[model samples]
Target: MIMRPPGKSARALLAATLLAPALATAQDAQGQNVTLELNAVEQVDEACRISFLIQNGHDTDIAQAVYEAVLFDTEGRVDRMTLFDFGALPAARPRVRQFVVPGMACTALGRLLINGADTCTGDGVAPDACVRDLTLRSRAEGVEVMG
Candidate 1:
């Protein structure tokens, strides 16, 4: 027997199913937001590695996040910045991620700034997530000047 084509309602249902994950990836639980915090910076060889803590203040779990961290030199100029893409940062307990900038040393940087977030989502992050006002905290232990 030949299979019949799916009806209008069936087609609509199929489309929704295919698009659910994309729509669900940007929503937060009860409108609660997530923020990024710079935890530590270290230099290994010729590269500098910056670690951050992603806090999901919402009740729901987060699946993906994109953020940029800006590094300021001793002269108060933008030394280097890197965009970080995170995966499955759970809610409540903070998650940590590290970003590396090659041919750089931590000794020359003054501070790390959480410049902006591209997107962050529990269900689905809003289009304005990047523009939303958020706080940044720096917990750098100490820095040493390299010879």
Candidate 2:
């Protein structure tokens, strides 16, 4: 049996295999989706203050993004539903938005649901871009966030 060096095609295949992960990472970044995190929850002046950390990972700037948010009580029952306006999300930028729900205690919050995108407008953004492929996370204790 005789063994020889790899041919040009084999070398090319090896190079592609080595670069596959990097290419995939770059492609993912370019087509990344919006990420929303429940950053904090607190009580202020007899109200529940909800803070959200949002990052626009898309390639286009978002002029306006409003979601229909539903808040669940500690018993896992829907407490209230409201609109959250996350305005002007520039691409690759992270922003924080806070909303205060009057007459609600922070401890009463169990889950936060993103029902859907009520308003999603941008130059190159699709009609369902905001809700489509959305990434949701929760950093606040005792609170679960889901889309």
Candidate 3:
């Protein structure tokens, strides 16, 4: 049998094929898929205001989503923790929520950790549960998504 090394095109194709599933997972993790984006964290006078966007990817409407976020300092130590309680984040619509933390600033943050959804009840009468089966696309750049 004759053997030959893969060329550039072949290597590219092989790499793409191998990374397809990982790329899709990066875009949207398994289980209940949703996208959470950090909008801005700014220091307003004496308080810090953190804003983020949450987009629902399910067919059912999300009535409320409560999460606890932990902020780490530059020394990789726990700095502070806050709760983000959002209401009525409907399907296919992105909802923005802002929370203010006193005596805190964005500069003091080294990493953010989402500690999972405490409450993820769907909208309408007798809504479905959406918290038990949720996956997170944790980039780990500065935030770790634990869902």
Question: Against the true structure, what is each candidate's TM-score?
Answer: 0.64, 0.81, 0.64
Query: Which lDDT tens digits does candidate 2 get at residues 26-106?
Result: 768646688999999999999999999998888899999999999999999999999999999999899999999999999
Model 3, span 50-121: residue lDDT tens: 777777767678877777778787678998777778777787577777888888766776677777666778
Q: lDDT winner among the candidates?
A: 2
lDDT of 3: 0.69
Instruction: TM-score winner between 1 and 2, please give it.
Output: 2
| lDDT ranking, best first | 2, 3, 1
Residue 12 CA error for candidate 3 (Å)?
37
* Residue runs of model 1 more than 4 Å from their true location after superposition: 1-31, 122-124, 129-133, 142-147
TM-score of model 2 (CA atoms): 0.81
* lDDT values, one for every candidate: 0.67, 0.93, 0.69
Off by over 4 Å in 2: 1-30
Model 3 clashing-pair count: 0
lDDT comparison, 1 vs 2, better candidate: 2
| 1-147 per-residue lDDT for model 1 (tens digits) | 988898999999999999888766754432355666667888888998878776765665667777766767867787766777877767656788887778887888786666666666657546544335454566776532110
